[model samples]
Target: MSISLLMAVYNPIEYDGRVKRSANALAEICNIKVICPAQDFSSDCFNPDAFDVMRVLSPKIKIQALKQIFFWVNFIFQAIKLRPSIIYAHDYYLIFPAWLAAFMTNAYLVYDAHELIIPNQGERISKRDNFFYFLESRFIKSADLVIAANQERANIMGEHYELKKIPLVVRNIPPMPKQTLSDKLVFRLYEKLEHEYQEDIHIIYMGDINLDRGIGDLINSLKYLPMRYKCILIGGGPSESLIKLSHSQDIIGKRLRLLGPVPHNHIPDLLRQGDIGFLSYSMVGRNNIYCAPNKIYEYAQSGLPIISTSQEPIVSILRKYKIGELLPIKDKNTPLKIAEYIKKISFSNEYKHAIRKFLLDNPHKSEMDKLKDAINGVIN
Candidate 1:
């Protein structure tokens, strides 16, 4: 039976590891239809053929309320036109529309909760969110199946509702490619960086560089590092101001590279040259504490030693593998401590080999299999 997948996300085409992987995996089992919002209505990134396997389109709308209304109307109209056997909503924004559409069409509704919607991190739960949470509770009771990105999220749902809902844990882990870049391309990229600072130990940071992401601490920590190590801040967010702070400190001229944002495909090759990887988001909320970010797996896949804050799942994994350093978030000399830690890890062959082996052995295969089975069972 064919299944329609509805997602409410910002940019679906850019190589967001989780979204792309999930979309591709779903397409393997069913006729997938992804509906998302478009920043620019004319952008061709939403072209269905670009993904090669699914039908993707932007339900063009400007405001949030209007978007929600249009989405349900369009989804119901499309359900009648396409005749999908089941409907799946990826996150909260798509939930109401999918729920209404499924009810009208008598189709099974699958809700994929990538994060905790009500008590989310970084944003306060306002009256609007509380009201939505009440509706979300009802929707969960009504959904055919519920999928969460991690165990912590599943537990959150269990705390609030008591339905016969089976929560499937579908982690946002990326598949690591076995092949490395060609020597020629690596050399070319290395040469570009070499032109700037030949002696600097390059450290790489990717993903949203927001305030909660600990970019400020990371920049401040740079002062504690030895003169030979330089930091590269990739991706965009509030870190742009931190980049400026680095400049005022005279570190930006030679010791810092702020490449605002790059394409996701370019990240692997970019990571290859870096001596270390960093994922240092602040653990201020339940979502932050429980996050098993894609970057953690990405760093492992890239064979780079990671430096992260001692958050729950990340600290647990880092300590378990002994491949990365989990430092206290509020240490006064955090930058120096991190620098020293990096220096130690950079020279350790044993740690490097062990991490690479662990990544290869795990490879997120079991997680993907479980998710595939759960989705298949629900849709069937």
Candidate 2:
């Protein structure tokens, strides 16, 4: 007998790697159904037969806050109608509504928190964050189960909520299927560069480009780097302006290649073209240190060494795995230090292949199984 599980997610079906993996895993034991935003509904990962996706019209630019309001109103009603065995909420905003739906239908409630939403030391916590924290705490206190993306965040949630048990840590990692780089893709990225950059070391930073994500720092630091060291930023965000600024500059202009946002499915192939992956989030708060971003896995999967700031968990992972070096964050000299570090390292094709194998082998399906079991354990 198959049980019914309802997943309420805010993102489109095409992306959301974490949700896609979780849904596929849950489908093994449940009749999986998804309620997601109608925009960008095309998906490459999901099997249409195994799951049914209900599309809801998401609010556009106007009255953006009302979007959540509209979604919850629709979600709670749908949850009640579906009467699923479980209501899995992907965002904190949906937690309260999912809890209410679970209460109304006697279904298990699961909250999947991807980050440390609460502010850490030295960071400003606005009234809006406070209000959401109140709702998040309420859900943590009342929900049948809560899952954080990392162990540190799980501990933080437990301490802050004063809960008897810590939330389970289910990190947002991609599946390890040993993907092969396409022959055509081997030179497409290099073809974008001018003849001068044919010999440059192609450093890439592929993800959300924003202030907190250290895009400004990454671009500005390139000025100190050698002319032969080039950077390709392969993502878009509110910080597109920063990229424009870098593009307009005379000194670092030619070296910086800003590309449009690549879809999640094509990211791995794109990442394979880079010499190194850059990850440098400004550490204004513990969230930056405690959180684990998907790029770490993506970089390793691409067999690219990383030039990253010493963020916790990420730092530990890098050091343990020996995949890359942490860029020393000394002010005024950080760029020079990064340049120096990159210049010193060398990797051969043999070593690159080994790194890719290590990445694929390191914590594969077993970790995902543990995550799947954590959710199913709630029913037991």
Candidate 3:
């Protein structure tokens, strides 16, 4: 039996590195295919060799409604062609199309809830958002099996739907490969950065660069630190405006470098060059609070101690494992507290040892086993 994963994305090229790793790992055990709709742009970054890549040709529509219709039309056409035993929809938007196809083809439908799709009713939800939530809840409750990114997200969905079995929590963790950076590649990157800027401690952030990602706070915090501290913003989002603002604020040009969106595979080498890795998001919603971001695990695997906010499972993991430090997201002195924590960890061998041990352990083996069981459950 084969499984097809349908994923809705802004940039289909920007496959979550952890998800790709998990997909590749899962492919080792099962026949798997990935189906994604065409976005405004395309890239060769996706690994065509790992899984069959099925792309639906749809015109780029700015309106969300039109985009949804276009995607569904192409998805239905493709689904008819590749009749897999099971269909796994990555997010709510992809679920409706998969449901339509499943009904016609009589295939098992699986909902992979990566985030809290239903918006808080109390908050201002647009009419379109409300309709999507209604469809999501109905289809999710109807799916043969459900998969959630974290326990908290599963709980939220359970509150709204009557699901007999609890959705399986598949934590987004990176597969730890026993590989080392070649000294030549390491030294070359080091020399390149050194030539561009002074030899200083390079702190790296490698995910979406949005307002809620705390980029402003990060840049503000840098102002309080010494000139020896440098930051490399290695992703793209609405917050690229902060780059110009950083320059206008007279934050050292050499200290803050914005290398716009590098390919996902290239991130590990970048993380290796950094003194510390950072993952901070404002806990504005339940989704943000419960996020088990891929970068956190990547940082841990790279043996870099992290500075993060007191969010859900991440905060619990950091505190319990003694692997990193967490600051209050809303605290007025958050930037200062983060800076102090960085200073402490940078100088402490104990913290470094904790991070090293965490990496050496590679705690995601059990999580991957759980994922494997979930996939098997759907098939068997």
Clashes of each: 1, 0, 0
Model 2: CA > 4 A from native? 40-49, 59-61, 121-123, 177-181, 185-198, 239-253, 347-361
- Over the stretch 13-108, how does candidate 3's per-residue lDDT look in tens digits? 346554565566667666677766654555554655766656666675678678778877777776677776766677667778888888877778
Root-mean-square deviation per candidate: 3.4, 3.1, 3.0
- Residue-level lDDT of model 2, residues 160-248, one tens digit each, is 88977898877767775344546465356445433354567878888777756766766776776778877787777886577566757
What is candidate 1's TM-score against the reference? 0.86
TM-score, candidate 3, is: 0.88
Regions more than 4 Å wrong, model 1: 1-11, 39-62, 120-124, 163-166, 178-192, 195-199
RMSD of 1: 3.4
Query: Model 3 shows how many backbone clashes?
Result: 0
Give the CA lDDT, 0 to 100, for residue 205 in model 1: 85
Candidate 3, superposed: residue stretches over 4 Å from native? 1-14, 39-43, 177-192, 195-199, 360-362
Candidate 3 lDDT (Cα, 0 to 1): 0.72
What does the lDDT read for residue 112 in candidate 2?
Answer: 86
Q: Mark the 10 consecutive residues where model 3 has the least summed lDDT.
A: 5-14
